[model samples]
Target: MRDIQHIEIPGHTLSVRVDPGPEREGRPALWPSVGEYPIYDPFLYTTMTTDDERNHRFRAALAHLAPDRRILDIGTGQDLLWAREGVQAGARHAVAIEVIEDAFHKAAANLPALESPDRITLLLGESTRLRFAPRADVCVAEIIGSLAGAEGAAAVLADARTRLLEPGGLVIPHRAVTLAAAVRLSDLLPEQPVAFAEAALPYLRSIFGWHGSPFDVRLRVENPPADALLSEGAPIEVLDFNGDLQTQQRTTTHLAITRSGLVDGVLTWLNLWCLPDEEPLDALSMKTNWATIYLPLFDSPVPVETGDVLELTFAAALSDDRVHPDYQLQAVLRTADGQQRRGSLISPHHGGAFRSHSLYRDLFPAG
Candidate 1:
């Protein structure tokens, strides 16, 4: 490929190079235009750095490593902090892999200045496809998404367990769980159900059509009010990095309505367990980059009274694209007077498959 080329955006000009390879296929452009630095945002890195609980647990796990033990850090960002910390913690060798070219270069520049520079080997490639000489004693990767396994962590760690690590090797986060709870949404519309439904008319049309719902989004609410919670959170799915990858899981939980309120939908988050005995890191209330995922049920909130039982059955599966996961919730709410109401909420599931169909070929021809 050629060297860096300059291109202009709305505010400024940028220097960037287009990477021509299969790895870049189907991936969204890193910037607004062609000639812009890929993965240039520093806010995400800053958020991760400020997460003291996450950093402390990882450092504690690194402290358990003995001298001369090999460590593998997958998806190492610009700082290469995990690999550097491993080397400094008495690891004999540290292999850091970063796929993005710009981030890899930044990590390379920072690696040489680390405490044990000679012990770290920087590789510019994806960990899922790359192979190393010998198995590592410890494997660490921070590919976690909002949902615990939504970012293909289970698949990546499963592959690494068999191919990249030695027998009984340690994975930084050995266990993870996606937790969810019923929540009463703060009113977004001035009027009640009518206004909300009117606002969502466009989305409803798109969702039922050949395309999909553009409003399909995850919401992040920081420090929600106490009244927002309708029921206690329950674990939707549990993932073991060292064990089988749960591409699809079916679980059920019961939510008892604390008080009479209008419940909007379920709010979900992740819990990561770095050590066997240590407390799992919470994503809902923690100072981490991950935000609580809000899955709305209806256009407006559903009314419920105190002592209502919400029996929720959730079926979650990783999408075929291996990025976002699909979730289907079947809820049966029983009132105190023995009246039962059934409601179902499903995320965009078959839309991608429909878009790929031959009959719908013209809908997304460019794809």
Candidate 2:
């Protein structure tokens, strides 16, 4: 069977892996929805706007709490959905913040066209940097990244609590946590070489372009196999948006192997709750825009049977911009053979090293 396939058309030529099996088999492909680069695109906005799960939870929370209260909507995006929705829900007034200028301008131009536009205030700047008076009674920000706080939600929300919101004010998406587990990459894709789908190439280039170079940007896999997981997932990073929230964190968790298999990496996903008492939306189990992330640890596969232990160390810290996070993952696999296999990955939000790893090397081939 062919491991790879080439397809050519008039304007473009492409070579892609022949998916080992049908879609149910979980052939991994690169997708652009997971990262938080603050770049605005039409399709990306469409995904967020159309996500009924996200919309229902957020709208319900807003409708319930935003009434008769001033609202603060950070990263309001171009649609101004939350800000407008908050007003529609009976908010006294809503302050909408957008970091991307184009989006902010688009929102600025459109806010006036909507009903009760006079009650919405639009700002063009980072919510963390911009200051406003008479704090709101509710802060609604859907900036939670695929990896939870990967979008600077912790830092941004923490700042909101202290400066943007009134004391004891409500925060939408009350909590978010990152879950991780040991996985055998080959099981996810039998003998396929890791590569981006043709549709993903443009966005891949955009991510690299935004970062100034391909410096190990976070990789999100679409349609990962349920059986690919070698161990039960455990929470590695937890961000309590309405409570104690920190910008930097280091967490170590042990995942016990549940089956006999080879190990090479950890798969991580986000669990988020719009309110304290609500059920969380799990990325691994649900069909949200947030895709599960593959944090590759080992290049060479390590043999492991049931009862092996993989200790994973995950760290998230603010980069220079202080608006996005840089993530580092370290794994130590302890098996029955009395030997250990160790691997680590340093993923920065922006430039650190160009094409630093094998996956990246293949993503951006030699020119």
Candidate 3:
């Protein structure tokens, strides 16, 4: 690899490198194209064809359009398929907005000869807050993340709807469905058996009178679409899956423990994509740009019993590598004895050095 120095924040020097590409601003290009990690735009993370569900949703959103309908593509990447499809469905103009300078140029260069050069227009700006002289009849924004909370999708959609859309205009990616469930914490890592000695030994003496190691439950899910964003305190239900399914886009839900045992940690997973039909979404059938962002719910010793309800408040937000781009776990466990314990884990990052501060506080809170 060639050695290339780069700058992140303007007027500041940072140790970063640009991939093989034309230089932009003050630094070399980040990647040769847009599919690499540390990508400027999240949309580049996914292949256009694999997102059939969202593509279908976007197409359906424009099906009712009449000729000459003006549409705005918020967070539009190098691909202008939505605009082209919208035009084919009667939309007259497609205006695109992007924040990354490199992606902005890419979109301009790539979208010009798409369906019609005169029909598409690309601009550079923030999607969360944008201004346009000509209002749009339809707005298409695909700013979803691994958990429906990255890239400020909520703010961007809300702002675009309020400031840029015409009344009765439709938005693409019609609806996103989020589901949730309760499974034994141990079920998440069936491939790796945990050591009873290493996991259970330290919790013998605790304020909760926990005699054994706290058992951790894991909940795996798929990334969600922007339309069906998950929030803290959202209500959810555990639906039945045929065991043939592998991934899901679940929301905050309550888990009832069937046995009395120590409660330790939680693992969360996400899946994001659109399905054309009820083909049963799962890990085997889907490919995502983002990997699983797991957060441990607790690091202390706790206990639970049959019928104990773990109330969860799941939320997703935009973040960087410095911090997780989205959050997936928020739970409050209600024991059979009427005790309330926080179920959201604050352990260190996975495979990284474990930070004992939060775990220590959880295990032994200051009196």
Top TM-score model? 2
State residue 184's C-alpha deviation in candidate 1, in Å: 2.2
Candidate 3 residue-wise lDDT, 13-63, digit = tens: 222222233233322111111111124443442455356644655565567
Which one wins by TM-score: 2 or 3? 2
- lDDT of each structure? 0.64, 0.81, 0.45
TM-score for all predictions? Answer: 0.74, 0.90, 0.57
Model 3, residue 329: displacement in angstroms?
Answer: 5.8
Candidate 1: tens digits of C-alpha lDDT, residues 7-51: 333343333333232223222111111001123235556667677
lDDT for 360 (candidate 3): 31
Estimate, for each residue in 177-230, the C-alpha lDDT of model 2 and write its tens digit: 999988866676555556655556566556655655445667778778788999
Candidate rank order under TM-score: 2, 1, 3
Which 10-residue window of candidate 3 scores lowest in summed lDDT?
A: 28-37
Count of backbone clashes, every candidate in sequence: 0, 0, 16
Looking at model 3, how many pairs of residues clash? 16
